[model samples]
Structure formats: structure tokens, C-alpha cells
Target: MLIDEVPERAVRRAGAAIELPEGLLVLDADSGEFGRMPKPVADAKIRGLSFDGARMVLVGGRGTCLLRLADGEQCWYGIPEERYDEHADLSPDGRTIAILTCDEENAIISLLDPETGRRRDIWSDPGTASHECEIRWSPAGRTIAATYMIWDDEMDDDALSTVVVDAADGRVLAGPFIRTHLLGGWLTADLLSFREEYDDLHRLQRLDTTTGEVITGPTIPGRVWAAVAGRHVHEVDELEDHHAEDTTFYTTDIGFADRRPLFTLQPKVEVRYFFLAAGVSLPPSR
Candidate 1:
């Protein structure tokens, strides 16, 4: 009897900070799929996400955590007093990290030097608080676009709005645009993105940071996740809404907004795995 040779396939280790429709789950993008990151720590309700194209930084509840894929490591960092976590983003060059902090009484923006783990108090607003939905920086890192929602206990409504802040002086440059969220925006020399409700199903809208004019995308259904730039094929899994305890992980597309069902990913069947090679050392940040 004789055996034939079979080629070996390489496995990639990956982890994802999944923003589920109802809850958030940090699952092993490779394997160990069912093992969910604890609910409370996962912050079932994540306001925003920022990826420097390498590590991912997650901000929610009262803390911010940094996660890496190659080694499967996580680091938790807390904000200063009177400053509750809201949303965060990385600077264009990826040297500094900015976070919005709210206290119920007012809102402020702070910047952290990731290399040194040092934070600087940048801007503060006494009259209002920031909307927790989204916060982003422009390509130059000179301006910030923040969505601000107003909470009215009497009317029982969350009114939508946005503000453009000058990073240098912390001054409101544009507005307080009223009644909007779920924006697909970008920061060039100019800032552009569409602002719309979940039901409106807005396409990518380009915005002018100086004039506040918008160029809209084609109308579509459902909410927009992230923007895709090129022709890279992606597998998506549209998972049904799940409660914190019952569900493990669901399927979704990588390029979901394109309206192209190009690929399908089954979490269990199609997966990746990471194993420690003998004598390999883990870094202190992990």
C-alpha cells in the first residue's frame, strides 16, 4: 500500500471586535469562536471603533481597551475623573489618540500619546455633551467631526446633531447640525460624509467641513457599517440579532454596504487558528 502527498494549507490567527446589531462580541477571528469576550467588559453597546490598520482601539462605557491580532493580546486603559468615555479616534499619522469624555454636565475632548501613555486635556464644552454615536478626525488631524445628540427627558427623544471642532483651539467651527447620525464620512483637505438615520438608509455622502455642503450616495436599505475603497472580494455573514447569553457569533459581510453579495462566510466551517511557536516571546503590551 502507498500514500499520496497532500499540500498543507496555512492557517491565519485573527480576532474581531464584532459590532452586532444588538450586542458587541470580541471573538477569535480564527478559532475559539464560541468563547465570547465577557458581556460587561465587551460593552454590549459600543459607540464607535477605530483601526489604525494594525491594532484596534475600542472605547465604550467608562474605559478604553487596545487589542492586537497577531499575538491575541488586550490592554485596558481608563479615563480621568469627571470624564466618562464617549468615542475615540487615532491621529492621521497614528502618533496620538483622541477621546471624547462626557460628565452629564458637559463634554470634553482629550488626546493621548499612545507611545508614552500620556493624556493631554484638549477641549471642553460647558453648555452640552457629545453624542456617543460617532467621532472622527480629519486626514490632517486639524479638525474633528463629532455627532452630538440631545437627550430630553420631557419629550423622551434623542435629537440628533453634529459639530466640527478645530483641534488646535477646541472651538466649534461649523455647527450643531440638527437631527442626524449614521454618517459615512472622510477627511481629506476637506471633510465629507452623508448624515442620515438608520431607516433612511443613506449612501456615502461627501461633506465640506468649511461650507457644510454634502454630496450624497445612492439610496439603499439597512444601515451602513464601514466604507470600502477598492475591488477586494469580501465574505459577509448577516447574523440575526442575538441576546448576550444565548448567541456566540453571527455571519456578516466584509464589504456590506456595496449591495454586492460577493462572498459568504460561515463562522464555524470557515475559520482560522493561531498557535504559539516554541521559544517565541510575547511582548509586554500583550
Candidate 2:
């Protein structure tokens, strides 16, 4: 089935907020209609959405603002003068927000209280030059995982790493694992799945935060987009015609068996990221 309501050029900036050139279109999944379209701010960029899809974080030339989708209420959080490429993720409960900010010499992770717009710096990489910082809260909101690409002067190439930190106090829990990138989902509250590259291949693996154990899972195809919830994998099917007017999204088991068509979009939307709604249950992997 094709969804004509979705604009062909609409980009999923983060969460349920679809990015248009002028502003954002909030999709109400339950109502099957577009919710209030928030007015565009100067150089507005959608950062992320709350777990329940009722609120979103937007950053622009002025600063960062938290917008409530139901009533258009806005909460402004001042932007740091030294920060560049700031990214934010709302906690599952929507009370706390994890913000990652990077500059030429350091990357800083901080916690923000949405109610009062107060912020506390939790973690910082003092001398490392880092960018593309992405942060996510664990399912239970007890920990946060941050993945970022760093300039590896020793290797003379860009490398990736993932770090897990205690959400309450920013205690380093498991990693700043080299060459590992979080796959955007946790298998369990303490078990995180990520993509590891070695021997010229990319493989899926899980890390145990409590016991510091690593479990290698499976080798992922080059075209796979992301491994979600440790159960299903989403990928672009290269076997299908790439130039078709409609684009199909497919999901497979963890092992890449039993592929199923999830949905098709007319006019072919170019998607860089996809997020599942909160509390959506997926079938067990075979």
C-alpha cells in the first residue's frame, strides 16, 4: 500500500516530525492525519521527539526550543555560544533531555531539565576533536549511549566509537569502544547492540554493560539501514528496482531470513533514518 499523504521530499529529521523546507509536519500515527504544523524558525532543524510523540526538540539560529505537538506550547533552551552540531534526545519519560555538543577541540554531553531549562554538564572529551555526536537513552532511562566519529590521527582516517554512561551521574559504564557504532537499539536494559567493523567487514554485536561481555551476532549486509530492537533489521532491498517511482521498506529477522515488506511509499522518499514508535511490539526473531 502506498501512502499518498507523505510528501516525496519529506525528510524524517527525527521522530514523528517530518522536515519540509519551510517547517515541520508532525504526523499523528493514531489519528492518521497530520497534526499541527509548527511554524518555522530561522534555520530551523528538528533535533528529536519525545518517546510518546507528543513533543519535539527543534534547534535553529536563535536557540533550541521544545514544542508540544498537541497545543503548540514552546519552551526555549539557550544555545551555547561555543557549540557546533548540537544534537538532543528526549528521555523516555520526557522529563530529562540528553544533549551532545561538539566543537573543534571537544565534545560535551549534558543533561537538561525541560521544565526549568536548567542544564548540567555530565561528560566531556577534553582534547579530542569530535563531531557527528549522536546520543540515545536506554530503554529504562538509566543509561545513555553516545556514538560519534572521531578523527584518528594515528590511523589517518575517521573512526567511530560508542560510549555508555550512567544517565543519573554520567559514570562511564561499559565503553568508549573503538570502531563500534551503536545500532540505535538495546537488546536489554544493559545489553546494547552495535555495528563493529574489522577485517574489512561489518558485523553486528552486543555488549553487556553489567558484566562487560561482548557477544558477536551476525554479519550485516552492506545495504542494511539499521538493526532495530535486536529483533528486526530494516534494509533497502537492492534486488528491487532502484529507480522505481515507489520505494518499499522491508524488514527481516536478525539473521536476515524471512524478509517481509513493511510498507511502500509513493514518489520515493529518500530516507536517511527511521524511528519506531514507542511501545510498539515486534515479533520474536526466529
Candidate 3:
């Protein structure tokens, strides 16, 4: 039994779930063949993907391309070698796929028309001028909030700015507040949530979309992360050392009661991660 003869196994599969014309991609953790779906197309190593009504937008180490699943003949590519996510959202009734990729200077946000393979720059600064680090659109589809990390070569200092803007015209409406780690999205239509400085506390906080006032949420201890499930917020507070972690613990409150152990995750491989992808509906603030 030679070491080379042992088939190379993927320790993990990290990406978003996207649909093809045939069927939805299967993503079962700790499984066979590089988290590939039953379909033959899943065999292609992809970094990220999002399917709109007419086209499938894909981004990976190779490049960003759009494929028309009809006859498997339609395809287009422009931006190459970058990472994207659901952040590269395909609008419900539109033909544009907007995605963000990191260039040397700032986070380059662009929109791609899968049909023509035309890439349009929505917001991006020329190398090292001012980096648009990240952008997240409101679930309502009317506003966009982004983190702009600014660097000064003259003084050798760094500044962080967060802003909410009109998704359509790109008009700045909110604060360019000094913040990072946008933990939650659209707590209210006029509010956004983020995490405080990791050293002081691991807690959830909110920023007023209009006035840019800081509002505090629940405070959990020890490098914690949270996800909103229906009516409750679930928290994952990690134990001492994350590496070589066997059993991972998490907690959540069922009702207006005590927060108890929601569950424990056992990792078969050395490298492991716990991710929660959820969508919660929030009412507009009055």
C-alpha cells in the first residue's frame, strides 16, 4: 500500500450552494469526492456561485464566468482569480450579477451581465487610494452597507469606515463610522449590526442607519459568534483552544428562559468549522 496509491481526500468543502439546470448541488459534510453533487458538473472545482433566473454566475481560482445551463453552450468570463459569495447576488427579476473581489488596493465591487460578459465597476478605488473592503445589501434590496478601510501612506495609519447607501444610485446615506466585522444584516431596515473590539468583549451591537448611534445587543463571552434562527438568537461560544478541538459546544434559548446547550458537533477531520446560514425577517423600525 503506497502513500501515493491512497486516494487524495478533501478534508473540507467550503462554498455556497448553487443550482444548475439539472438539479440543486448536494453539500453533505464529511462525504465522498470533494463535496461534489451527484451531477457531473459538480466535479469542477468552484470557489463560489450564484444562480439567477436565466444564468449561473461562477467564481473560482480560474476566473468568474456565467454559464447558461440550457444546451451547456452559453458561457462568459471577465474577472479572474477571486472569491465571492451570496454577496454576489443575482437580483430576483434582473439580468445582472453583482460581486465583490479583493484587488491589491481596495475591495473591487462589480456587476456582470451574464449574457454579454460585461463587467461594470459599481464601487472601487484605484490601487491603495481607498479600499472598499466589503459590501452587503439590505434584504429589502433598496440599500447597501459597506465597510471602507482607508490607509494612509503619508502617516502610516489605518482608518475604517462603514456606510449605508442607496443601492440604486450609490448615494451615501449613513455614517462612515469606524467599525468592522458586520456580524448581522438589517436588524431593522434602518439599522445594521456588528461586533465590538474582540479584546474588550464578544458582543453584538447595532448602528442606526440614519443617525449612526451605537446600540448594544447580547454580550457573550470567549470568542463567540451568533446566528438568528426564527425567533431566537443562537450563540456559539468556543472552548479554550480551537485547534485540535474534538467536541464543539453551542447554546441557544428555546423561549424566554435559560440558554442551554443546543448541540455538540464532532469533527472527524483535524480542520473543522461551524457555519450557520439563515434568513430572518425583521420589521422596519418606527
Predicted structure with the largest lDDT when compared to the true one: 2
The TM-score measured for candidate 1 stands at: 0.60
**C-alpha-based local distance difference test score of model 3:** 0.44
List, residue by residue over 1-286, the lDDT tens digit for candidate 2.
Answer: 3344544232222234444333444455554444334354556556666666667676655556777755567787886777653667788888898877665677777888988888887887643323344677887899998887666677787777788899888889887877777775565667777876453555777788889898877766534544445455464544446556765556666665777765554555565544444443332221
Residue pairs in clash, model 2: none
Ranking by TM-score: 2, 1, 3
Error of 3 at 230 (Å): 6.7
Please write out the lDDT profile of model 1 over residues 1-286, one tens digit for every residue.
Answer: 0001111222222233333332333333344332333223456133333333334556666466655534446566677776677677666566767776667666667777776778876666543444435667766678877765665455577665666778876787776656655343342447545465443454445567778676665543333333323211222223332222221221122223333442222232322211111111111111
Count: clashes, candidate 3: 0
**For each candidate, what is the lDDT?**
0.48, 0.63, 0.44
Off by over 4 Å in 1: 1-17, 20-52, 60-62, 126-132, 151-156, 187-189, 197-205, 215-218, 228-262, 265-286
lDDT of 1 at 137: 73
